[model samples]
Target: MELESPQRRSTMRDAPWWRPLGPRAPWVAALLMCAVLMSAALFIRSTALESSALVARGMANVIMVAGFEAFRDADGLPDQAALDAFLASHREGGLRYVAVLEEAQPLVSAGAGKVGTRDIQDGSPLRVEGARARLIHRIRRPRPVLGPLTLEETRAMTSVGDVQEPRKPLRMVYEFEPLTALELESRSQRLLGVAVASCVGILALAFAFSRSLAQREALAEELERGRRLAALGTMSAVLAHELRNPLASLKGHAQLLAERVESDTLLAPKAGRVVSEAVRLEQLMNDLLGFVASGELRRVDADPNDVLRAAVETTGSSRVEVRYLPSRTPWPLDAGRLQQALENVLRNAVQASPEGRPVEASVEHQDRSLVFTVKDHGPGIASGEEERIFEPFVTGRLRGVGLGLAITRRIVELHGGSVIARSHAGGGAEFRLIVPARGV
Candidate 1:
């Protein structure tokens, strides 16, 4: 069975719900979330401002009405001394001036500034207006009785003004200056800054959470792939073991048949073909078994150049060009297993190169690790199949069972090394094998 490629596996799996927006999802989500928070902050600020304004107006009206009631006598007529005393007590309480208007004429005035009849008549109840410095005022008409004044009583008394005409109902006007626009603006800006800062902090936290979740998801996926590969290795080992005996018996019978067949007869060629096919099958079984098998390594300190030369000689290829950069210190490795792994890679490189084109092999030390590189001049590995080619039974060629690279990888891994394949800059495939200088 073919193992699934990493790309195919990822594509087949369903992505997390939050991943639909792709890599920039965090930034996009953060911006949109912050925008919504800012809108809410603005909305809340507007609502709070409106509420505060309403409360201020209501309180001011209450204060003015109370002052008017305090100045009135039981007969419901304003007393001059009482009005003066009430104004004096609340002079510093944001109350600029207070006046009593009778029939569009000022009757009793207290505090600063002279009051005009038109000013009292034109002023509405609890009105505020300003550009730079805000002015708020409350105009109230005092009731004849004072306590729990009703609208019906106010209208009845005003309607009978010509008959009784007791004193024209008093229009109590109170004016005060509130906060300036610049001060209020500065306060609002501070609130907005705090809201913006809060939003940024929340976005940062959300981004961190998303990053952590992505890392855990990736780790889980890697673990799952490892499990699948382990199970596959187990199954392949069992199958290879079962087929070994029968494959060996078949090869032996084919060899006996070839020996018995006469060389001059037509049966000889057919028997020879049978023996060759049987040999191929045996080799295929051995390759599969070797890939699934685990073994101990006999590590020893050896020169990397000697290993590379040995691998090149094993391939028996005259078309290979070696560029060996000798290391100062010898590398510790399993000589036999390392040579086998190198031979497999070198042979593949030699096979991949055109007849005249030289296969380039190189050895170098980098960052405490020995690096071996083999480059072929033939058609490079197909795009998106670099990692898949190392899987068992996966092949780009038509010939033998595709277990050479797989077995090579197993051997190198046993020695705690890594093998990677890529397309070379000069138009071919390149394989790099990196091994630690000290054996694991």
Candidate 2:
């Protein structure tokens, strides 16, 4: 029935993998949300860029086709002046160069620099070259022909409308400059950077919020625990008061009965049992009263060694071995209250030891505080019951009501002291009580 350490218990609660992440859970969720948003933004950006590229290419084709049609005559021969004007109008629209080819040769060209020589065939449609985009259209027309007997041919041709032969197709090749892939990629990267920065901000804010929330929860839990303790104290006080009068009357009657039946052996034994039980009940009631009362110390300058010796003698246990190391100055404490606390602890240690085993009690001064220790060479306190032993009505012993150590703790705490229980390295239970030299 040993009580667990507060730190150990808290560690156990957070031991599960998922439980350890509770405080950080909000931050994790926020980061995930940011990731989702960033992914969506990038997806939309990529889609828009792709669609824009398609639309730009479509619009370029339309502009080139319209300009080519406007320059051509009814005979399907391009006007040089009209073609020059069309090229000038689109010069600022990334149109680097324009060329009209006839029979795989340049017929007319307009640009800041010479257009490169490239293989062009009739009926070749739109195509892309390095740093340039091109559209090609073929134009066909009738060609005039002369036969032998020029005067007769002229007269026969004059009688008919006109005699014509098929001519070679003319290839209208229009080349324009287009945006580079590197420039588009740079723009997309800038957008991605902005999204990433926004996500980082979101995560940071989430972590801060989570930290504040965890602190609030801890404070609330502490307040709740204090409220419970205060309520328990009130209830114990009422019960102790209600039971004390009846217990005192019972003890008095039992004592009188034991005296009256002194001569009859059987009757005397029965009366003795009743008296002993009453005494035990009275002691239990006293322990309850002490535990519930608000501890108010009557402070005086006293020697810690003297207090230890007095407590050991009060326990009336011959099995206790006393050790004391005196300090230069006496400490301020409520001597009676401290003696009672020590007596309770010393009694527990002595009771826990076997007949032959000695309980060790020691007192010393360290770090301006009186340090009292009691240890028993017996089965140590059960694991996980070290702290619980100090709690009211919690004990490892079968017959113990468990209020002794609880009362001891209250008295020690009232004097601004602390008590801790642990298993000694040599295999026994050890209790250490530390009281500050200055009174509370």
Candidate 3:
């Protein structure tokens, strides 16, 4: 009703939450994200480089230790030099040691027990048998050492009998990187990887949450709509019952008026028109009542073919011969309702059928359901409207009210069946329907 002044408007528009600030506004960012990252990376990288040689040597020691552990954890004793050489390599990157611990003798018996027999024979090409069944193991606590550890520091970690020392040295090896550039590089890459992974995980979570919220909102809307329809149906049912009897009486009175006068030819035609319209009105009222009780159903076992034949006869189409093989398949049916439904189908077939072309009614069994097909040579329904024609009050006829098929479908659905209309591959239209068998 009232426009704001310029000062008030500008103040309102300048609020932070309402502003669009992102990749789009590159020139003047809401704020700059100063990358402490590069500085942090430099510090870590520098520290790592200063320590590289120490780390490489430390890693080599760890490799030796790890190899010694393999011997201790093995099924039998390994060639000592080969074991030491393995540990000296592959265990780099400032790691002091990585080893597997097991009992003194591994081959004669692998399960939990004390050191047993010397099961392994001494040889360059080792020969062995039985599974090297691994088991739960533990590492020995390293004895303390107090000196600048030498590269031979790896020897202390070997299995008791593995090398030049049958009895391994009793000392813990301690080592650290001397602060170097390579360490800094490795730390920077690790930090960057962690940051990127966290950002991606955050975005994925946001999208999933948003989609879930939207689906919940849509479901809530649909449930509310269904509640409203249920209320509307109750009111319509009440109104239809009240209107039917009065409408019938009105038609009867008009008929009486037509019989009472001879000079009322035009008046008689007017009375007939009144009666005709009244009948149409009654039919429309009945259809509304039908819609209100669309869910109510009574199922029984009955022959679909018999029901279809009866409907054809009721249509009074002497020229439209109904052809169907009498099949013994019994379907779960609501007899009166099924008759009404099929009669509607036949009526549409009869209307669509060209005079000498016989409208067809066939029933067959497929899977656990019964299928009823009614086809005619009449021009096919308009392509786009095939689905719409099933709605209540939609008709193909020039003056059709369209309710015929809608009511028919309601009858079919109550019996756990569905109807569909499609163009026949051979040029006409076919209506194929399936209904579940009764007591199956």
Runs with alpha carbons beyond 4 Å of true place in candidate 1 = 1-35, 45-191, 326-329
Candidate 1 least-lDDT 10 residues: 131-140
From the highest TM-score down, the ranking of the candidates is: 1, 2, 3
lDDT of 2 by residue, 1-440 (tens): 99999999998987766456767877877878898979977996797678646644774687667665776453445557766877788776666666666566677777643434454532346555555666666655435454566787668867766766656666666676656432464567687888888888888888888888798778877798668777877887788889889989988998999999999888999999999988888887777777777667788888888888899999988889998884545778888889989989988888888889999999887787878999998899889888878877777778869888988888888888899999999888999998976633
| Best candidate, TM-score | 1
For lDDT, the strongest prediction is 2
lDDT (CA) for every model shown?
Answer: 0.74, 0.77, 0.60
Report the candidate with higher TM-score, 1 versus 2: 1
Output the better candidate (1/3) by TM-score: 1
Screening candidate 2 with a backbone cut-off below 3 angstroms (N, C-alpha, C), the clashing residue pairs are 1-385, 2-384, 2-385, 2-386, 3-384, 3-385, 3-386, 3-387, 3-388
Ranking by lDDT: 2, 1, 3
lDDT of 1 at 202: 77
C-alpha TM-score for every candidate: 0.63, 0.59, 0.50
